[model samples]
Target: MPARLFAVVFGVLLTPSFLLGQVGGDRLIARISRDDANGDGKLTEAEFTGPRRLFETLDGDGDGVLVIEEAAARLAKVRSNVAKAIENRSEEMGNQSQREAIRRRLQETRGGARARVEPDHENIRYGDHERHVFDVYLAETEADEPAPCMIWIHGGGFRRGDKSEGGLFARSFTENGIHYVTLNYRLSQHAIAPACFEDCARALQTIRYNADKWNIDKTRIAIGGGSAGAGLSQWIAFTPDRADPLADDPVLRESTRVSGIILLNAQTSYDYRWIQEHVPGEAWKGDGLQQLFGYDVDRLDEISDAKFELIEECSPLNHLTADDPPMMLFYRRSSDPEIAEKNAMDGIHHPIFGTELKKKADQLGVGCEVFSVENENDMRVYNQRWTMAVDFLKRQFESVQ
Candidate 1:
């Protein structure tokens, strides 16, 4: 209780692997900072358990430098461990028929699977994790013109979701002469925050790396997703360019920038304060943030500086800059009370996220549109919003010239 409470008060659990595994950094600082749950940027006795031995093993020399082979080996182990965890989760579910049904529902809606249509590329692997794959749906698009792409990330609060959930997007975009790609990133059930972002970034990079062969316009790519996926898209589009010119890997060398972004039922900020301030009446009791952060609220009086800073760093609101691409946000303006009653965090999809995001975009002179739906208009409202977003994306793509 005390350990998890430490997280609730401080905000966010430590995740140093993003630094250690991706771009080598101060080994001691990276390892200790992650284990340092209180976020003092230094490890305490209780927090000293993480990354200590792993660093030692990786740093074979008495010198503190991490070697190339060692880093690669470490990353491989991490990927292997994450993949095994997912497999274990599947076995634990113990319901083969239910799982099959979910897979069917993924590629098919009420209208049944889109048969007789085959994707240009299927199960393209972008990373080591099993979920780090994507499907590409290519239109009979113009030969003279490279098709603009829409990469959709699926949303399930970083816990339960798959890229196939966005399978419907393939036909919608492809029919309009745009190539569409739906991707699966690492989920918290197997991995967590940085894993999700890293997977998404790598997938985009992989697409760009193969843009020419795939007939995709590298300059006109648009990103989008729902809920957690939406947050990932915003983080990539708004966050400063992550292109590491110094990295040796070609994929890592590719740019993470996009021409436009679309967000649905988005989370504009991971900050608890932002959630509390913008949410509708009496929605403060939700602990969804804690789950997303993979923490348990301790209701402690004090906070951790490092943890708070990390949370802010991860929040898309904090990443917004003048250079961000145009964005279209879709959300619900109100909640169904009955539905709201079922989930403690029903207001997560509220328009407040879009409302606040619009305010920030206005401040930065970035193009941002917010669409709020108060009632069920059936697929009519969705089609309208989709049309607007696709038009916006097409305009953005054309302007890329």
Candidate 2:
């Protein structure tokens, strides 16, 4: 009787793995190797100990047993394991199904999984002091007409993020007959204000210089990004003719005239005081922003208010004008009480759209549209926002026509 209980429990625990192994032992082994609790590269003694107990229960009627009750219990445990394996496989199938759907749709309209636009990389020096290179995504979108173009910047605060981050966005735009470009710039930690902006401008010039080969539509060009990239995108959108003409390159003569803007959870402006008042915590403190201006926020007074002047220069809000491109801002609301329950720190730092930023866009008559995402994970919201961006661009192009 004592060994019978152990066998029953052992059978219950062992049956699941044995069952799963029959169906997809290789897959089960792979997942176990990756996420196993003990990390012994294989299931450890502690892991198998419970299964051993279940196996013992399968030896009932205790005359060194092999009875009907023990066999029935083992069979039931095997069934349970089989059910669990099916459930896990079903989940994997679902993800594969989604990817196939997206791929099929893309093939129906555009070409295969390959990016529609051919990408090119080149190294170039911008200004006398700052030297950086950029990558260009291009295609002969039209035979006779000039295709609309977009310069896509990536976001990872000002410290991180790269140009070739999202192939999906590039493919989406290109498939819809829009040409686009993406480039890398000097990061914030290494250089101060205007260096990123300057590098971006130079990259634009390089593209324009070779525009003939790329078949760029110079008259209809736009810039866009998310987060810090959105901030930079917004800055370039509104600040027309900000590029220096005195620079050696003719590309600098070209204007950054985007007809519309798309921003996602972007820091619209860098007011440490504003961020501090609303955002709470030292995460958005001035020290980080101060680094952009080569000064410490604490030392701002001694530096003759240079911090404030730098703030003005770097703030996207300061660059906004009545003629700025139409703006679409997507943010979130804090309606979920369970946010903290799900995660302690994430619940605290969840981004909320500021009212004043929306008001500023409205005041400028910038064709601003603001929306809030609720009750869903951010990845879902990101998909929705990408659709909105596509729609927004379509409408903007249509209105111009």
Candidate 3:
């Protein structure tokens, strides 16, 4: 896990303390309860069907449903897989702190699943790419009452991130009776610019198209994630429907409207012009924005008008309109003096991103709440409002009128 996620999810720094070590059985159940569709302690056929053979082999009674032991076994398998994945990430992800943090999490899950929060459905493909996979974590909602859903995208500066990190958000939202989804999209290295954002849009449509099967209330859906994920959530949420209404495919016909959005330190704009105007001299890091849009500053003189329009279209700030959904953005509070002392591009976490978006939302009469560590209880770094964000999302779902 990245420090951002470890801190946000565990309510503790991903330092030597390793808060994940405290994970236990009940806590694990709370993580994966989203698919507990009936709020019961068992897994039904409607709620689970792992890689087929495993689920079938575990079905001792020839009945499709699984008891707690079976469910725990399935959950344990998920943890083991996740542990191995994180182990690989620790070695290959290129960040020292992130690598060490993932190593700690790897050790925790490898010790044995402390929490039985497993993906009821894993690696369900939304597109042909190897990275276009998703995991479903169901909430324990009443049989007749469909639950709202939130899709989580991981933050990795657009090049690296895992769908498995929805552990904290999955537990938080599913415990509150909201279905959760975490997905992997193609990275900038594989496909740049709009491709990743389009994958998210496609995933939302695919998920909503199968809403009836998943027991999701398609009308009450939201999109969010951390950093890059948050930015793409805003991209999808704020933009008009990517649906091709005339297309033959049913999935492409689904609208991408989200009732609410949750953003954690997301970029306000990907346009380099905005970066130049907003980022302070000391904090300016050409590489951060360059990595996403794939245009070097030195070559601006050679860029074309069509490319410029496409860049503007990719910027979340440019897409905001009155029709955009409710949004609650969280960031760490900082003083002007502190901003100067920060490392390059750390300013992306500064309040300016949230405040500027809030300004536009206020102008359009949209519901936008910008919270920072200084005033908002949920905005603290180590102890983020994982539950409060869900509450805000549900309120947005309920308040749709």
Quote each prediction's TM-score: 0.67, 0.63, 0.70
Per-residue accuracy of model 2 over 1-401 as CA lDDT, tens digit each: 23443343323334333432233334433443443453422232233333433323332211111223225544565445434443344344454763343334333332232223346443334444433555555543657776767777765556655554544356667667777677678888878877777677666666666666667766566677766667777777766665566866677666656667776556667666555554544534434466666666665456556666766676677777887778777654342434423432222223433345668778877687766546457535644665677678877876766
What are the per-residue Cα lDDT tens digits for candidate 1 across 16-92? 23333332234534554555454433222233454543443333221122334344544454434333433444454
Each candidate's number of clashing pairs is 0, 20, 7
Best by TM-score: 3
Report lDDT (Cα) of residue 236, candidate 1.
89
Off by over 4 Å in 3: 1-116, 282-284, 333-341, 375-384
Top-lDDT structure, candidate number = 3
Q: Residue 191 in candidate 1 has what lDDT?
A: 65
Ranking by lDDT: 3, 1, 2
Candidate 3 overall lDDT versus native: 0.70
Clashes of 2: 20
